[model samples]
Target: MVSHGFSAIRYETEVKTNGLSSVLMAKCQGCHQKFKFETSPQLLNNRNKSKHYDVNVRAVWGSMATRGGLAHLNESLATLNSPGMSQQTYTTIEQEIGNMWGEVVEEDLLKAGAEERKIAMEKGQFHEGVPCITVICDGGGVKEHTNIHTMRLEGYANSKGTLPTQHVCYKNWDESSQAMESNIILEGFLKAET
Candidate 1:
């Protein structure tokens, strides 16, 4: 009788790239067993139920943090002889970052409002059973008042030693920038009323 230890061995490799990181998947031809080797860890993207390479997210984040956009990122990648992501992928990541920023800003605003309310209550700063707080409004232009582009409103307790908290911000482009300050301030006050 003759015994054969193994019949044959064959394998195939597939590479998946996400920005700078890659996953190399190897499969056995005979047994169809697959194994994945990753160059970097993956992050779970809760918005789309997808996994993103950590390096990809980091690259996008670094670009945004420095006020750079997709073009700049691509330029840098090109300089390094690396393939860059498509515009669609950059936009998707940008949108995700914007959503996360909005959530964080909202949470901070709520906490600040609660703190202001507490301070007002402690200082007996109430009118007709309603808490009374003071708000500061500011507006700035790119160069002149005619070029006004952004407006900000902040709220603080009436008592001294209380820090101000940002409540609302508006960026105007459609209407005349001159009137943006008044309009945004009014809107901020109206929102605070509720």
Candidate 2:
């Protein structure tokens, strides 16, 4: 797989040289939003630097981070390192991978929820033309026994099964306020039309 990826990138570089390099358009795995980035054929061929400078390489990095978790990324990077590779290069790649993982792509998720709700309404699964939904809100301490606690809200449509329409997390300073936060989240969801 790695060899094929390298060959594909090499082929693209060789075939396209109108402006000295190729501009690779990468998309987010979650939101499917395209982002443009440029990379040179020389950079791709260089053995001293990490190939992550290339947009294709960055997409692979993001996919790996999203699918296999960070441990796998760390292991892969360890093998890719050469004696000439600088620490800064590895740091940059790791940072990019971390950023990819950190993105929740909430916009895409919200769109999906809206579509699901529309389908459910058409099917007449809702109660009295109103959506039959579940508002699950909870708050608990962090790390099991830790004092830090946070309230979270998730809305589930009956037709949507386990999928949630929205998921929100709210910080809490005191355990007593947790119930209030949960109530607020539930009330807000209940008031909103599906």
Please report the candidate that would top lDDT against the real structure: 1
> After superposing candidate 2, which stretches have Cα over 4 Å from the reference?
1-52, 55-81, 84-87, 97-104, 125-130, 133-194
- Separately for all candidates shown, the number of backbone clashes (residues 3 or more apart, or on different chains) is 0, 0
lDDT of 1 by residue, 1-194 (tens): 12366534333454777667777776655667778888889889777886767887888888867756677888999999987977666656766776788899889988988898899999999988977787654545322222111121122233445543432223334566555676765776579767
* Number of the top TM-score candidate: 1
Question: What does candidate 2's lDDT look like per residue over 1-194, in tens digits?
Answer: 23533422222222222222356666554455656556544234333344544533453355344553233444554676611223344344545544544554555656766886787777766877665544455565222222111111122244456554332223333345556657656665676565
What are the lDDT scores of the predictions, listed in order? 0.66, 0.45
Model 1: CA > 4 A from native: 1-14, 25-35, 138-185
TM-score, structure 2 vs. true: 0.30
